[model samples]
Target: MPAHRYSELHTIPFYECNVNNRISIPMLINILILASEHQNEKLGVDQLYLIDKYGIGWVVTSYSIHITELPRKDSVVKMTTRGTSYNRYFAFREFWLHDQDGNELVKVESIWVLMNEKTRKITAIDDDVITPYQSEKVRRVPRLPRPGRIEPEDQMTSKEYQVRWSDIDFNGHVNNSRYPEWMLDSLPMDFLDTHEPTNIDIRFENEVKYGNRVTSSVVVDSSDNDKIKTVHEIKSSDVLSASATIVWKENKAEGQD
Candidate 1:
């Protein structure tokens, strides 16, 4: 088969949106994961095959996605992805989201590290995997900004969510990815649907236990418009649970969370 690169599409549904009837953070994350699965098919490996064949997995270390518009219920959105390059431990990939009419909606670039299953350390992507994709080396690298932080004394907002039995993973705690839900959940309805998040750096600080009430809050720095930073913090009293920053595009009216 000839080696080629192509982008696939995914549609947004009503359940994917939040109270604002806009696409939620969790749904956005879910869409990207699905897009990657299809993109891998073009490279002779879907998500499942890649994980199983190499005993290797791709984890998102950092990502920045700018959303120009929200995909409404039953609206079809097209997503295109490409492996831009690989520099040792960092593999660069770009994804573009668009309307069926071909208007670009969101642009995302993500950095990932390949990991060994049992040892859980960074590893190299072999030539076999590398050669299949016609990728060029990204010469000029753009530095991503750091995620935000919240002080211990900072006043915070809270949300009480029951750790349903289904939310518990094999590790016996709420899935780390679920924190984005709690984080974004703290934002306003208009903010959830609009605004493009130009940057977002999330670090998992700790695990959220089942049946525990996790309060969430955000810290915003009003200094720069080129980049808007909002910190997502999940905590109990003074103890921290997890934190994330959603960097918005110049337009703050769209994504408040």
Candidate 2:
């Protein structure tokens, strides 16, 4: 079956933007995620329906994102998403953000799996549960590139964060969008203000529960003048929960552009 696409227009809110007046990465991800959830609702497969019917909910496993530029605060943009395909265990989805003139600003490819809410374990995706999206079914699972790991030789810095109640989503775990925020928070403010991520690759390994104190470790490499790379790992009690690598480019000064 052909894939179904859903799209919406969004005005980037002030709260979602960073000090540079561009939409922040984590909130931008949240917006894209909401678009997908909205699509599922339209397909009669929303989270409430899934959990109530099959005791399962959608969990994101990984995301690969590329950015041409970030939309500024109060800017109207079009966000589009679709379920590309699915296998026995994994589903592939795509998302895109375009400016007012239809110029592509960001593109993302993501992988998702069904998790049993009670067991907190991966559940086999039942045909009926996913067929509503009209995604193609295939026997072979798709392989997404894994995020780069932190190297033993790399110098690292760490930050601790307490998972607040607000961070929990309907899935009862730390929202996937918050993972990036935690990872990014480990960086220096000067770096964040001057650099903007151009590419980000992140993978979630374990679910973090409320009240858990998670540690984010990061290693930044600025050897290349053109682009800076940062590798990150998030752990709770030394158990790896997530990891990511982000490539950034220095932004021009506020008034220069």
Q: What lDDT tens digits, residue by residue, belong to model 2 across residues 129-165? A: 8888888888765676788888788899999999999
Per-residue lDDT over 118-217 for candidate 1, one digit per residue giving the tens place of the 0 to 100 score: 5667797666665666655455434444467787776656566666777775446676457787777776656655555555666554556778777878
lDDT of 1 at 136: 52
lDDT of 2: 0.91
Candidate 2: Cα lDDT at 139? 79
TM-score of each: 0.74, 0.96
- Model 2 RMSD in angstroms: 1.4
lDDT of each: 0.68, 0.91
- For every candidate in turn, the CA RMSD to the true structure comes to 4.9, 1.4
Residue 68 lDDT in model 2? Answer: 98
Q: After superposition, how far is residue 56 of candidate 2 from its true place, in Å?
A: 0.7
